[model samples]
Structure formats: structure tokens, C-alpha cells
Target chain A: MITLDHCHKYFHKGSVNEVYALNDICLQIREGDFITVIGSNGAGKSTLLNCIAGSFFPDSGTITINNHDVTKWPEYKRARFIARVFQDPLLGTCPSATIEQNLALAIKRGKRRGLGKGVKNSERDIFREKLGHLHLGLEERLLDRVGLLSGGQRQALTMLMATMIKPEVLLLDEHIAALDPKTANQILGLTSDIVGEQHLTTMMITHNMKHAIAFGNRLIMLHQGRIILDVDGTEKSKLTVDDLLQRFYTVQGEELSMDSMLLT
Target chain B: MTLYAALGAVEQGLVYGIMVIGVYLTFRILDFPDLTVDGSLPLGAAISAVAITGGINPYLSLVLAMGGGFCAGVATAVLNTKFKILHLLASILTMIALYSINIRIMGGPNIALLGTPTVFDAVSVLGVPPYLAGVVVFALFAILVAVIIIWFLSTELGQAILATGDNPQMITSLGVNTHTIIILGVGLSNALVALSGALVAQNQGAADVGMGIGTIIAGLASVIIGETVFGTASIARAFFAALLGSILYRLAIALALGVEFGHFSFNPSDLNLITALLVVSALIMPNIKKRLMQR
Candidate 1:
């Protein structure tokens, strides 16, 4: 569980070009809440996630992760309870490292690494089993460099890696946005399967409206550094993209403008 | 070349092989083009020579030299990471500062260890011929260092170091403080370079402030030669290749100096040119092979 109280993040404070990336905000994310977030460019979706992940500290207010204040924690320190898969395939996994080596790194997530063998023979079976689940034939190619894998395979590996240690929170930053439709669908299926099996507290930022509506138990829409809509369970299930658009108009008292919101 | 000359080259090669391994750690493993070795090598030599002149045990002087080099590396890492200085610039700054530091450490520009009992002299008491003593001592230490480095690189912390170099963001997300990893990795690299410098000072019986001027080039030449020739499919292979590469590089230099080529023999001053040519060929060898294969 995570909570943000009156969090504010400003870029270039007091300067002429000042911009508020996150405004006064309060959010309470419950355990096992698979939250799908939808927003347009500069809507603070990423800024919100960055705040929770400790990439940027809020100018005001506190971030509590399971009752521990983590506002001052560095990115690496907050990683003890958070795992992230970046939108860029290259950002999530080490390309030059072997598949097994990447998995080995993931297996020790949030833990102190000592002077012991990285890829133990005993752990290889677990890695193999996990890789086998991806159906990417990466199990047999553990020694092969990860750079040689396809983009979709790499993303899948990254997802598996992010959840390997079962972090307190999993953040997916438009992870499937870069893939082709077919590969995107496959990864989406895999993401759902993994999240369902683990019941992970996940926050996914997506540009695709269909996925934003289809995947998670709850959906929250962000607009101009603030949450505009929050719907869940049966209310979330019965809603359509048209309903989302009407709600956007009703909430903001203006017509929806972002084509990305409707096209996806 | 004569057998004695070949053995002598091997002796020098084995000693510099340790420095080549250090170079490999920064250049290949960390993807850091650290210029601090130019300073750290002399720093080690200066410390060892100074310590030896002060009546310290020759072997113990090497340890002190390594400590000095580690500090130099940490300074470079700190400048780069904490101060936000570019890595290359920070290393260059360290390298420049070390010039004065080395002179200060030795109390002058140079220190000679004439008549002092060195590691080679200690090995000579084992009944080995004086001509073979230098190579034997260097080989024993080189192998030990190689084994330790290989073992260290296989560890979890070592893997994190590798990941830090490979993907800093991913490693940071995995809860690794990449700043610490960079500090440790670069520190270890320079320490090894300093150790080699210390050994070289003992072997040649003197440490000159200018002794480390082209040390980085030579180390890079050896590593590129090693990786180009022997391949780096595995960590152990890569480490051994670096050592082998250093020996071969020394032998190549020896061969170059010895070859008359119809009155065009290479002199000592042409050593830089020779190193440059070797590195150029090594850099292009894969491409040449690939082009030939297409035919």
C-alpha cells in the first residue's frame, strides 16, 4: 500500500519558465490495487509515478509506502519496495548481458548483493522455469546475449524480471506502447497472467484507452497534474470509452481535445 | 630474438600483464575510459620506490602502492559521480594532479632501488637461474591475480558492477547504488594498475615520475589485442586473454625492436608508433575477416 499526501513537484521553481509537474495531490493506493492510469502528454501521469518511485521528491507533502515515509529516499533506496519496467525496451533490461545474467540480477532485487556466485546452479532451474513460461525459447538460450532478442521478447523478459522478486509495487510505464499490435497483444496477455497470479499492487500508465479500460480492476484518469476520474469494480466494468469521454467533458466542463485519448 | 631476450620480454610482459587486467576492468567491464591509470601507475611506482627507500619490505611497498592508487581512483569516481564531472575529464584531472603527487611521494622526480633486495631477488634463492627469476616471480603473481579477478567477477557484487556498467538505470531500479558500484569498480582497476607499477619499479630498479606517461595506451593496446585475438566469450577467458594479450604485445614489441628490416630497425623511441600500429590492426581485424568471408 502507498499514500501520497498533498504532494507537489515543480520544475524551475520561481523562474519564468516554471511548470508544475505535479500539483497538490493526495492519493491512497490499497494493497493489490491494479491501477491503470490514462492521460495525455504533460498530464503528470509519469510525474505521479516518478514521485512514488522516488525519482523525484515532492516539494511538499509526504509519500508513505506501507506506513514508511519515503519522500527523501533516493531512487535505489525506494527500489527496495518498487520495481519498474520502462517504456523503452532498452531501459528495462541490460542488452549486453546474457538472459540468465539479467534474470540473476532481478532475482536479487531489493536485497544486498554479496561476494557469492551470481547465477547459482540451484537458481538456474527457477530461471529456466520462469523463462519457459514466457514461451520465448529463452530458457534454452540463457547464455545468449539479451541484445539478440526481439523487442517483444525483451519486454516480456523485463516484465518477468520486475515481478521476479515480488516487489511491494510494480510500475509499468507504457511498457507495450512501442510494440506492434500482435506483439502488444501477446505481452498484454502475459502481463495480465502475471499480475493475476501474483496479485501485485501495480500502477500502469498507458496511452491506449482500450488497454486502460480492459486490464486493471481500477482506472484513474489524470488531467493537468491532477486526477480527473476514478472508477472501479462494477462501475469500471460497465463503462465504455464513450462514457469515459462524456465523463471527461462533464468533469472538466470542456470538450475533450487529445486525439490520443480517443484513437487508442 | 635470442632466448635471453625472449625471456626478458616475457618478464616485462608478465609484470605489465597485471596492469593490462586493470585496464580491461575499466575499459571493457565498466565501459569507462578512465585516464587515471596514467597517474595511478606512477603513483604506485612512486609509493613503492619511496617505501622501499625508507627500509620497508619490498612486498609490503606494493600493498601501499595499491592503496595509493585506490585512493586516486576513488577521487576520480567521486569527482565524476558526486561532483557531476564527466568521467574522462575527472580522470584527466586526477591524472594531472598525480604528476605532482608522484614527485612529492618520491621526494624528487625519481628514486632508484639499486642494491635493494626485490621480489625477483627473493625468488632467485629458490635455485632458479638469475635470468629466469624475474619471469618466475612475475608469472606466479600474475596467475594469482588472474585467479582472484576471475573469482571476484563471478560473484553477485561483481555482477551488479557489470550491470551497473551495462544498464545503470536498471541496476538502480534493482536497488543498487550505481555510484558506489562505479567507485568500487574504478578503485579496484587503478589499484591493480598501481600494483603493476610497483612491480615494474622493482624490476627496473627505479621509479621515474614520467614512467607512467604512456601506461594507459600500452594497457589499452594489450586489452584490444587480447580481446581481438583470443575472444571474450566468458569472464575467465577474457581475464586470461588480457594476460596473454599483454605477453604477446611485449613479444611483438621485442620482435619489432629486434627486426633489422634491411637497415630500418625499430628503435625504442618508435615504441609508441609500434603500439599504435598494433592497436589499429587489432581494431580492423574483425572487419577484414568479415570482408574476406563475403568473398
Candidate 2:
């Protein structure tokens, strides 16, 4: 579980171009909760996840993960309990490294890296078994550089890496946004499968409203650095794209004019 | 080239191969363009020469020299990582500071090791010919260092270092501190360069302050030439290529200086020019070959 207390984040503070990225936000992510976040551009969706991931500390706030206050920890230190899959497939894996090497790095997450062989003979079996499950034929190309994989395949691999060791929180920042529709659906299916199996506490940001409603048990809508809507359980299950848009219009007094969000 | 010159070139190549491997670790593996090796090479030589003249064991002095080089490398890494200076400028600052430090360590511009015992003296008792002793010893040390590096690269910590160089964001998300990894990598690289310097000083019977002037350039030339001649398909192969490239580079230099066509010959002072040309050709040859094949 993770909790944010009075979190506030700003960009270019005190300058004329200053913008309030996250403003006086407080939210608690419960155990086994898969929360789908939706917002238009500059809604602080990424900043909210970043503050929890310790990419940068909030201007003033406290974040606690699993009962430990990690607000001041550096990004690498906080990574022990946090796993992330970035929007850019290239950002989640090393292009020059082999598939097995990348998986080996994931396997040792949150653990001390010592003098043992990076890819042990025993771990190769595990990697093969896991890659086999993805059905991407990556099991046969463990030795091939990740650079040779397609964008969809890399994103799938990134998803696998993020969940290989089930962290306290898994953050996906538009992880499948770059892929085509079919690949995105496939990756989304894989994400749901893994999250359901592990009951992972996950926060996924998506631009598509249908996906925001289709996936995750809970949904939250952000506007102007504030969470204007938080629905869960039966309420989330009964909601549709129109209901969410109507609610947003009443709260913010403006139509959700992002065409991509409406159309998707 | 005469047989004597050929043998001497082989000896020099084997010794310098250690330095080339250090260059490969920084420039290729860590992707850190470190110039500290220029000064660390002389720092190693100075420490070893001074230690030997002061009555310490010759082999032990090599260790001391490596320690000195490690400190120099750490200084550069800290300046870059902790203080946020550009890596190139950080290494240059360390190199500049080390010039004065090397002189202070030696108490002069150079140290003579003509009479003192050396690592080569230990091999002379094996009934090896005096001319071949230096070659045998240098080859043994070079191979030993290469084997160690190859093994280290396959380890978990080594993998983290590789990932740190390949993609810092990916490794950091995997819970590894990239700053610590960089410091360790740069420090290890300079230690090897210093060890090579110590061996060179003993073999040449003196350690001069000016001996390190073109150290980084020659190391890079050897690395480039090795990668060109021998494909770097794997980590082990890349190291072997670097070592063999050093020997081949020395042979090429010897041949260039020895051969003459009725007053057309290269002078020793033209070594840097030759190295520059060799690197440029090696870098562009692959592209040229691809274009030729397309045509």
C-alpha cells in the first residue's frame, strides 16, 4: 500500500512561466488495487507517479510505501520497491544487451548485486519458461540484442521485466501508447493477466477513455492538478465514456475537448 | 626489420597491451571518455620507480602504483559525478593535476632504474635468453590481466556496469546506483593502465615524466586497430583483439621506421601522425567497404 499526504509539486517555481504540477493532493492506494488514471495534457498524472517513484520529491508532502516513508529517498533507492515501464520501449531495456541479460537484471531487482555470474545456468530455465509464456518467440532469441526486437515485442518484454519480481507498486506511464492497436490490445491483455495473477498494486496512465473504463477495478480522473473523480467497484463497472465525460464537464465547467481521449 | 628489432617490438607491444585493455574498458565498455590515463600512466611509473629505488619489492611496487592510479581515477569520477563537471573536462583536470603530483612522487623529472632489480630479473633465472626474458614476462602479465577482465565482465556487478553504460535509466530502475558503478569502473580502468606503466618503466630502465605524453592516443590506436583486425563479437574476443592489436601496432611502427626507399623513411617523431592516420582509416574503412559492396 502507498499513501500520499498533502503532496504539492511545481515547475519553474516563482517564475512567470510557473505551473502547479500537483496541488495539495492526497490519495491512498490500497493493497491489491489496480487503479487506472486518466487526464488530459498537464494533469500531473505523470508527476503524481514520479513523486511516489522518487524521480523527484514533491515540493512539500510525504509519501509512504508499505508503511515506510520514502519521500526523501533517491530514485535508485526507492526503486527497490517500485518498478516502472516507460512509454518509450527503448527506455525500459538496454538496446545493446541481450534478452537474457535484460531479464537477468530484472531478476536481481531489490537485491544486492554481487560477484556471481549475471545469467546463471539455473536462471536460464526460468527466463525461457517466462519468455515462453509471452508467446513472442523471445525464448528462442535469448542471446539476441534487444535492439533487434519490434516495438511491441520490446514493450511486452518491458511489462514482463516490471512484473518478474512483483514490486510493492508497479507504475506504467503510457506503456503501450506507441504500439499499433492490435499490439496495444495484446499488451493490455498481458498486463491484465499478470496484474490479476499477482494481484499487483498498479497505477497505469492511459489517454484512451475506453481503456480507462475497460481496465482496472478503480478509476480516477484528474483536472488542473486535482483529482476530480474517483470511482471504484460497482460504480466503476457501471460507468461508460459518456457518464465520465458528463461528470468531468460539471466539475471543471468545460467540455473535455481532447478529441483523442473522446474518440479512443 | 631485423630480428632484434622485431623481438623488441613484440616485447613493447605486450607491455602496452595492458594499457590498451584499460582504454577498451573506459571507451568501449563504460562509455566514459577518460583522459586521466595520460597522467596515471606516468603516475604508475613514478610510484614503481621510486618504490624500487627505495628498496621495496618490485612486484609490490606495481601494486602501489595501481593504488595511486585508482585514486587518480576516483578523483576524476567524483569531479564528474558528484560535482557535475563534464566527464571530459573532469578527466582533463585530473590529468593536469597529476603532472605536478608525478614529479613530486619522483622528486624529479625522471627516475633511473638501470641497476635496481625488476620483475624481468625474476624470469631471467628460468634459463630464458636475456633478450627474450622481457617478452616472456610481458606476455604472461598481459594474458593474466586479460583473463581477469574477461571473467569480471561476466559477473553480476560487471553486468550492472555494462548496463549503466548502455542505459543509465534502465539500470537505475533496476535498483543500481550508477554513480558508484562509474567510479568503480573508471578506477579499475586506470589501475590497469598504471600497472602497464610500471612494467614499461622497468623494461626501459627508466621512468621519464614525458613518457606519458601520448599515452591515451596510443592506447586508443591499439584498441581501434585491434577491433578492426579482430571482430569484437563478444567480451572475451574484444579483449583479445585489443591485446593482439597492441602487438600488431608495434610491428607496424617498427616496419614503417625501418623500411626506406632511398631517403624516404618515417622518423620516430612521426609516431603520433601514423597513429592518427591509422585510427581514421580504421574508423572509416567499414563504411567505405559497405558503400563499395552496395555499388
Candidate 3:
């Protein structure tokens, strides 16, 4: 349940190298909607997510999360209602911390943290139960440093961490792009299971077009800081990459470039 | 080593090793280069000495001395966290301020703490031998501090402080207020240093305003030697390594004073030189070790 109206974002505003990151964009997300975002580099896929995550303030827009204005909130303050998993696995976790400590921090995401004896036996049990579902054996290695983990395991752990308290919205900024294909697929499967289990409203940005088509009920193609096509339900199910290419041509009125779009 | 030499060196090492623990907390644990130790060490000594001369119990005076160092740390933390001063600048400001503050606290250049009811006085209160006081005091406090620190590092806030050093951004995203953690870590670290300073002043029977001139370097030397000797992969081993390193460093210095009488005078001035040489040796120890390993 999030909405953005007439959002505008500029980089280095009033300077020579000024660029428009988001321009007059409008988007709405329903509760439990899994939206896939696909675009070329500099297409504002990340800026859009950044805008939603309170990383950047829109120059002109009203953002409402579950009907409360959050446009002016700071990143730390917005973190109360939102959880994000970065593209890099390392970005989502403290490498030197044990799995249980990191999970404990995530569990108390919006609260004051202090020197309490951390992760009681019951909390450890809960984290292990959640980690067990990932099937990566992180649950068994709860005392191990997260730095020792493989990228895939870390990503899965981050996913588990992000939804530990089930924030109002989940932002996945190409959460699996850096992993090898098999690990990426595994993380994606974990993502689906997590989203389904938590009923989280999610926006996932990906460079891979097949994942864009296959993962979500709703798909939006962003080109030049604007949504070019918004398809969903059966229309999205029937759509192939070829059909998506033709639609991008019709919508943006430009031949599809960026080889990544066709190769995948 | 002779009995006198071993006892003297080990006692001094144990006292200064507490300073090393303080340095480890900020430089290694909190990742803050708090220069406040340069002033806080002498500040603790001065405060404890003055308090002891003022008819206060030496054990209580030592605690007050630690509190003085904690204040210095808190002031630095506040400047950096609340006033937005850069870390190095904040510590410089506090270190500079403490110089004036210590002069005012002692009301003079120095004070003596002998026969002043120090923590070691209790052993003699029970009619223990005079030579055993330093050993008794050192063992009790060093062991106590080590256990507390190990327990604290296992805590939630302590882990967050560790995480803050590794990546503040990740912790902040998880809603950790890193500034608070830094303040707590620095306060705790310098408190340990000041406690060491208090004991050193009492053991030496006097506190001079300049006793802390190379305190940070000495602490760094101990920590570096510890890490090089025992490795830094695990937390518990690192603490034990630091303890062993401090003892080793003191023994080496004692040996140098004993055998190198022709090369250099074993005076107070030589301490700075010795510390500088120890640091250089420590810096080169790792590379030398790696080269030796390759063979």
C-alpha cells in the first residue's frame, strides 16, 4: 500500500551536469502486490526505489505509505516502515557480526538497541527455524561470522532478515543480480517463498527480463524516467519477452536497445 | 631473569596493559583514534594522587581517577557525535582541554600517593608482605577487567559497536544509533586507561603531570605485539594475547635496561626512545614473520 504522485528527482540540480533521475512519475502499489521493475542503466529503476526507500527526496511529489505522507522522512525514520535488501550481499549485513546478532538487530529494527544479553534461546530458535526454511544451513551455523558465508547464503539471510518483522514494504534492488545463476535462482525462490509467507508489498528491480516476466503479478517497464508499460494478471502471464519488446517499442516509440534485454 | 627483575617488569606490564586494553577498545573495537589518552592518563594519575593526599581512600580515589578519564572520553565523544567535529579534531580538543583540567584538578604540578591507603594497602592491612602488594593488586584488577570486557563484548550493544566499526551503514539501516555506541565504547576504553594510570601513580609513589606522554604508543605497542604473536582471528584469544604481549614487552624493556647499559642510559628519557623502538619493531615484526614463514 504505497503511492507516489508527480514525483520529480534531479541530480546536481542547477549545475552543468544536471540530470533528471525521475520526472513527473506516478505509481501505486496495492497490499501484497509483487511488482517487478525492469529498465536499462540510468532508466531510474534504482532512483525510483531510492525515492520509495527515502534515500533521496523527490523535488516534487507526495509519497504515501498506507495513506500517511512519508515524502519528508529521513532514511532512519523511514526504516520504521520499510525494509531494504541491497544488490550487494555485503551491503545488507554486518560482516563481522554473528548471524544471531545481525538477526537480533533486524528484529528490533525500529527500536532503541542496547547492551542486553542478545538473542535468548527462544529468539535463537526462531531465527534458526526461519534460516532452516532457506535450506542453506545458516540456521546450524548461527554462531559463525556472516563474513564467512557465501554470497548466496548471505543474500538468503538478508531476505530472511528483511522480513523478520515484516515491514509495510520491502524493497529488493536487484537482490540476486550479483550471485551466480544457480544461486540467483535459489535466492529468487527464497524471495517468492518469503513474499508469499509474509504477504509483503514488494518492488524488485532487475536487469534480467525473464525474471521480470516470471516473478510477479505486476510488471512495469521503466524507460527514460517514466513507466513505459504496466501489465498485470493474465495479461502479464501471456506476455513473453518478445511481446514485451514489441510493447516497449509501441509504448516508448523507440527500438529496444541494451543487449541485456534480448540476451536474457 | 632475576626475581627482582621479573617481579618489577611483570608488575609494571600488568598496570600498563590496562592502558593497552583501553587503546584496543577505541582503535580496534570502536575504530576511533581517540587522542584523549595522551591527556586522560596523566589526568587520572593527577586526580587520584590529589584525592589520596586529601585524605580520601586510595581505592576510592582510583575509581574517581577512572571517572575523570571517562569524562575526557565522553567530552570527545560529544564533540564528535553531537557537535559534528571530525574524530581526530574532537580528540585533540579534549586532550588539549584535559591538560588545563588536570592542572586545575591537582591544584599543582604533581602529588605523591605513598602511604595513602591505595587498593594495595588492604593486603598490608591483613599483614601481608610488603613486596607482594603490587602482585596482589595487579592480579585482582587485571583479571576482573578481562572478565568484564569479555562479557561485554558478547553483549548486544557491544556487538553493535563492533558492527559499527565494520560497517556503520549496515547497522544504521537496521536502526542502530552508532553515535551512542561510539560514546559508550570510548568512555569504557579510557576508563580502563585511567584506572591503570591511578595504579601506576600509587605504585611509583608519585604522580607527575608528564607520566602519560607516550601512553598511547605503549598501548599500541602492546596491542600490535599481541595481535602479531597470537593472531587476531578470534576475540577471546586476542585478549589473552594482549595480556601476554604486555608482559613480554615489559620483560624485553627490562632486559634492555639491564644488558644495554653501555649503549644507552636507563633513565626516564629512555622510555620514549624505548617505546619508539618497540613500536618500530612491532611494525616490522609482521613482515619479518611473513618472510620467515616463506622460508
Top candidate by lDDT: 2
Per-residue lDDT of candidate 2, residues A43-162 (tens digit): 999998888888899999899998899989889999889999999989999888899999999999878999999899999999999999899999999999999999999999999999
Error of 3 at B220 (Å): 1.1
Which residue pairs in candidate 2 have backbone atoms (N, alpha carbon, C) closer than 3 angstroms, thus clashing?
Answer: none
DockQ-based class of model 3: medium
In the range B222-273, model 2's lDDT, one tens digit per residue, is 9999999997888899999999999999998898889798978899999999
- DockQ values per model: 0.83, 0.80, 0.53
- RMSD (Cα, Å) for all candidates, in order, is 3.4, 3.5, 4.4
Clashing pairs in 3: none
Candidate 2 Cα outliers beyond 4 Å, as residue runs:
A247-264
State the displacement of the C-alpha of residue B111, model 3, in Å, after optimal TM-score superposition.
Answer: 3.0
Question: Order the candidates by TM-score, highest first — what do you get?
Answer: 2, 1, 3
Error at A217, model 1, angstroms: 1.8
Candidate 1 residue lDDT tens string, A1-264 = 899999988999999988888888888899999999997788899999988998889999999998999999999999989999888888989887889989999999989999989899998999999999999888999999999999999999999999999989999999999999999899889999999999999999999888889989999998888888888899999889998877766756544445546777
lDDT to native, each model: 0.92, 0.92, 0.85
